[model samples]
Target: MATASLSAFTRGIGRYALVAALAAVFATFAALAPGFLSGANLVSVLVNNFALLAIVAVAMTFAVSAGGIDLSVGTAIDFASFAFVSLVLAGQPIPLAALGGLAGGALVGLFNAVLIAGIGISPFLATLGTLFVGRSVQQLLTNGGNPVYLPPAGVPEAFRFLGHGSVAGLPVPLLVAALVIAGAWLVLSRTRFGRVVLATGIQASVVRYSGIRLSRVTAATYVLVSAIAAIVGLILTSTVTVYIPSSGNAFLLNAIGATFIGTTFDPHGRPNVPGTVLGVLLLGIVANGLLLSGLNFYWQQVGTGLLIFSVLAIGFANRKAAARA
Candidate 1:
C-alpha cells in the first residue's frame, strides 16, 4: 500500500516538474537580468528566439510521439528555404514561392516515408541518411554550400510581412507559432487520428491488429512533421532574406532537446504539445537571459545543458525513491 502511494506521488512530481522549472527559471531571470521582463525584450524573445524553435519542436513532437525521430527535420527546413528563396528571386508570386518551399519539405518527408514505411528501415537510419543526402544536394546546388540571398529591392512586401510584420501588435511569427501549437494540441488530444498516433507509438502491433494501417500513419506523421518544418524555413528566409545551406541545423539539437525535456512532464513519459511549448520557452529564457548576462556562447550552452540535466535528474530521483519505497 505504501509503495503504491509513493509511486503515485512520484508520478505526480514527474508530470508537474517541468512546469515548476519553467516558472522558477522565469522568476530568476526576471529578478537577476536587467530588463529581462521588459515588454520589448520579451517580444523579441517570443518572435526572434522562440518562434522558429517552437515550430520545429512542435514538428518533432509528432515524430517522437509516433515512435520516430527525424534527424532530417533540418533538411526539410533547409530545402524549403532554398526553394522559397530561389522562386522568390526568380520573380514568382509570393504564394507560389511559399508552395514551392512547402513542397520541398514534403519531398524530404516522402523520401523518409518511403524508406521507413515502404522499405521497413529504422526511422533513425532512414532520417540520418536523408540528412546526409540533403547536405550533398545543397552543396551541389550552391557551389559548395554558398548562401543564396534575395536582393533587398526585389523582396515583396507580402513576403516580408510573414516574418516581420505585426497583426494586432503581435509578431507574425508568434501568431503562426500559436496556430501551430493549437493545431497540434487539437490533433493530439481531440481527434481519432491522434489516438491512432499515440497508440501506434506505444504499441505498433496492437494498432495494426486493430485494423489501422501502420504504414499510412507513419507516412502521414513524417509528412506533417516536415510540412510544419518547412513553414519555419519560409519564415526564416523572410526574416533574413537569405537561404543559408544547412543553417537549419542550428535548431536541430535544441529541438530534440526541447522535445525530450517535454517528455519529462508526462507521467507516462509521453511527448506532448503543451509540455514541448513550455520546454521551448524555458530554453529561450535561458538563452536570452544568458546573453544579457554577458556569458560566452559556450558557457550559455553549458548552462542550458545543466538546467536540462538538473530538471530530469530531480524527477528521476523522485521516481527511483518511490520505487524503492
Candidate 2:
C-alpha cells in the first residue's frame, strides 16, 4: 500500500514538474536579478524573447502532435523572410510582399508533403532534406550568404509596426503570438479536423482503416506547420529590418526543446499549445535572467540546456515509476 501511494505521489510530481520548475526559475531570477521582476523587463521578456519562439514552437507542436517532426521549420522561416525581403526590395507593396512570404513558406511545406505523403518518405528524412536544400538555395541566392538589409530611409512605418508597435497597450508581436496560441489550442482541442489529426498521430493505420485519407491529412498538416512558421519570419524581418540567410535556424533547437518541455503538462505526454507557451516563457525568463546575472551567451545556452534536461529527466523518471506501480 505504501509503495502504491508513493508511486501516485511520484506521478503527481512528474505531472506538474514543468509548472513547478517554471515557478522555481521565476522566483530564482526575481531574487537574483535586480530588475528581473520589473514591469519593463517582464514586458521585454514577453515581447522580445518569448513571442517569436512561442510561435515557432507552437508550429512545431502541430507536426509533433501528428506523430512527426519538422526539421525544416527554420527552412520555412528563412524562405518567408527571403521572399518578403526580396519583394520589398523590388518595390512591391507590403501586403503583396507578405503574401509572397506566406507562399514561399507554403512552397517548402508542399515539397515536404510530396516527399512524405506522396512518396512515402519518413517525415524526419523528408524535412532533413528540405533543410539542406533550403540552406543551399539561400546561400546561392545571397552569393554565399550575405544578409539583405532594408534601407533605413526606405523602410515603411507599417512594417516596423508589426514588430515594435503596440495595439491597445500590448506589443503587436505579443498580440500576434497570443492569437496564434489561442487559435492553435482551439484547433487542436476543439475542432473535428483537429481531433482527426490527433487521432491520426496516435495510429495512422487505425485512422486509415476508418476511411480517413491519411495522406491528405498529412499533406495539410505540413502546410499548416509551414504557414504558421511564416508568421515568425514576418515578425523577425520586421524587427531586424534585415533578412539574414539561415538566421531562422537559431530558433530551431529552442523550439524543439520548448515543445517537448511542454509535453510534461499532459498525463499522456502530448504536445500542446499551453505547454509550449509555458515552455517558451521558462526559457525566455532563464535567458533574460542569465544575461542580467552576467552570464555570457554560451553560458546562457548551457543554463537553458541544463534546465530542460532536469525537467525532462524528472518527468521521465515519474513515467517509469508510474509504469512500475
Candidate 3:
C-alpha cells in the first residue's frame, strides 16, 4: 500500500479507537473508585461541565467543521464574562450589558475571521494571537485583580435560572447544554450553511471554484464560536457570582481534547454534539472521581493531560488504520 493511502486508513480507524479508549478509561476509573458512577456524582459532573465544556465543545464543532480552529475561545470567554459582570456590578441593566458583551465576542470573532480568512493567515496562528489579546484585555480591564462581585439584586431569577435552576429534577445547565447540542446538530444536519462548512473544511478552494463564497462561511464560523463562548461566559459568571479573569483557563486544554472526540461521529470534523457532551461528562467524572479517590488536585491535572494525550494518540491511530483500508 502507498504511504498516503495507509495514512488515511489510519486516520479513519483512529476515530473509533478513541471511543474504545474513552470507554476503557471510564471503566478503569470506576473499578478504582467504587462510587465513581454514583447518581449524585454523575449529576455533579454533568452540572459542572454543562456550561463551560459543553458550550465550547459545541462551538469548537462549528469552528473545526469550517476547517478552522480558535485557540482564543477560552480566554475570549473570560474577557466576555469579566466585561459582563463588571457592568452588572456597576448597576447596568443585565440585558444591555449582556448584549454588549455578546457583541464584543462577535467582534473578536470578526477579528479572527479577518485575520484567518481575509488576510490568509494560518488559523492556528491567528487564533493564538487573539488568545493572548483576549486574555490580556481581560487582565488589563481588571488591572491584575479579581473583578468585583456581582450581587444578585435586580437580576432575574429566571436569568440565573439557566445556571442554577433545574427542570424536571435535571439541572438547567444540562438542559442548556442539550439545547445547544440540538441546535448545533440541527445546523449541521439540516442547513445549507452546514453543507457549506463541510465543503470548506475538506477543500475550500474546490468549493470556491464552484462559485461559492467560502470566506463568508469561514468568517461566520468564528463569529458563531465567539458568540457561543460569550453565552457560556454569561451562565458561568452568574453561577459563580464573581468574575475571575482566569476563570476560563481550564477550558483551553480540556476543550481541544474533548473537541477532537466530538469530530469522530459528526459530519464537520467537529465534536459530534452528543459525543462532545459525553466527552465533557467524562472529563468531569475523571476529575471528580480522582478527587473522591483521594488523589491530590495536582495529580488531577497531570492525569487529565495524560488522558487527553492518550486519547489523541488513539484517535491518531484509528485515523491511520482507516486510511490504509
Candidate 4:
C-alpha cells in the first residue's frame, strides 16, 4: 500500500512538472530579461512567436496521439500556402482562395493516408517520402525556390484579419489558436472517435479486433492533422503576404519536439492537447527570453534543446521511480 501511494505521488508530480517548469521559466525571464513582462512584449510573444507554433503543435498532437507521426505536415503547409497565394493572385475572392488552399492541404493528407493505410506503408517512411516529394514539387513549381509575393495593396482586408486583426482586444491568431485548442480538447476528451484514437495508439490489435475500421480512422486522423496545418499556412501567407517555397518546414522539427515534450505531462506519456499547448508556451518563453538575452540563433537552439532534454529526462526519471515504487 505504501508503494502504491508513493507511485501515485510520483505520477502526480510527473503530470504537473511541465506546469511548474513553465512558472519557473517565466519568473526567471521576468527577473532577468528586460521587457519580458512588458505588455507589448507579452502580446508579441503570444501572437508573433507562439500562436502559429501552438496551432501546428496541436495539429501534431493528433497524429502523435493516434500512434503515428506526420513528417509531411510541412508539406501540407507549403502546398496550402502555394495554393492560397496563387488563387488570390488570380483574383479569386478570399473565401474561394482559402478553400482552394485547404483543398490543397487535404491532397497531401490523402496521399499520406493512401500510402500509410491503404498501401500499408509505415507512417514515418511514408510521410518522409511525402516530404521529399513535396519539396521537389514546390521547387519545380517555383522555378527553383523563388518566392511568390502578393501585391501588398491588393491583399484583401478579410484575409489580413486572420493574421493581424484583433477581436475583443485579443489578437485574431490567439483567438484562432484558442478555438483549435478547445475543439481538440473536446474531441479528444468527449467523443467516441477520440476514444478510438487513444486506443489505437495504446493497443492497435485490440482496436482492430473490436471491428473498428482502423484504416478509415487512420486516414481521418491524417486528414484532420493536415487540415489544421492548412489553417496555419493561410495565416502565415497572409501575414507575410508572400508564399515562400518550403518555408512551412521551419516548424516541423519544433512541432515534433513540442508534442513529445507534452507527452511527459501525461501519466501514461500520451500526447494531449492541453499538454501540447503548455509545451508550446514553454518553448515560446524560452525563445523570446533567449533572444532578449542576446543569445545567437544557434545558441538559442542549443538552449531549447537542452531545455527539452532536461524536461523529458526528469519526467522519465519520475515515471520510472513511480513504477519502481
User: For model 2, how does the per-residue alpha-carbon lDDT over 133-161 read when each residue is reduced to its tens digit?
Assistant: 99999999999999999998899887788
Please give, for residues 1-325, the per-residue lDDT of candidate 4 as tens digits. 1123556546557666877889988998999888899999998999978999998999899999999999999999999999999999999999999999999998899999999889989889999999999999999999999999998987889879878888999998899999998888888777999889989989988999999999999999998889999989998988899999999999999899889888877777789887898889999999999888776878988988898888888777877886788
Q: Alpha-carbon error at 84 in model 2, in Å?
A: 0.5
- Model 1: weakest 10-residue lDDT segment is 1-10
RMSD of 3: 4.7
Error of 4 at 229 (Å): 0.5
- Writing each residue's lDDT as its tens digit, candidate 1 over 218-256 gives 999999989999999999999999999999888888999
C-alpha RMSD in Å of predicted model 1 compared with the true structure = 3.4
Model 2's TM-score against the true structure? 0.95
What is the TM-score of each predicted model, taking all chains together?
0.94, 0.95, 0.86, 0.95
Q: Model 1, which residues run further than 4 Å from truth?
A: 1-11, 319-325
RMSD (Cα, Å) for all candidates, in order, is 3.4, 3.7, 4.7, 3.1
Name the regions of candidate 3 deviating beyond 4 angstroms. 1-15, 152-159, 264-271
Poorest lDDT segment (10 consecutive residues) of candidate 4: 1-10
- Cα miss at 294, model 2 (Å)? 2.1
Query: Model 1: which residue pairs collide?
Result: none
Candidate 3 per-residue lDDT, tens place, 1-325, comes to 1122544434454545555766876788788877877988777767774456888877887777777788888766776777777677676777777776677667778899899879989889999998878777777777765575766676666457656888899887777777888888788767999888867877888989989887888888888888887777777877877788767766767777677765553322344556676666667767777777888889888987787677667665655555555
Model 2 ranges off by over 4 Å:
1-11
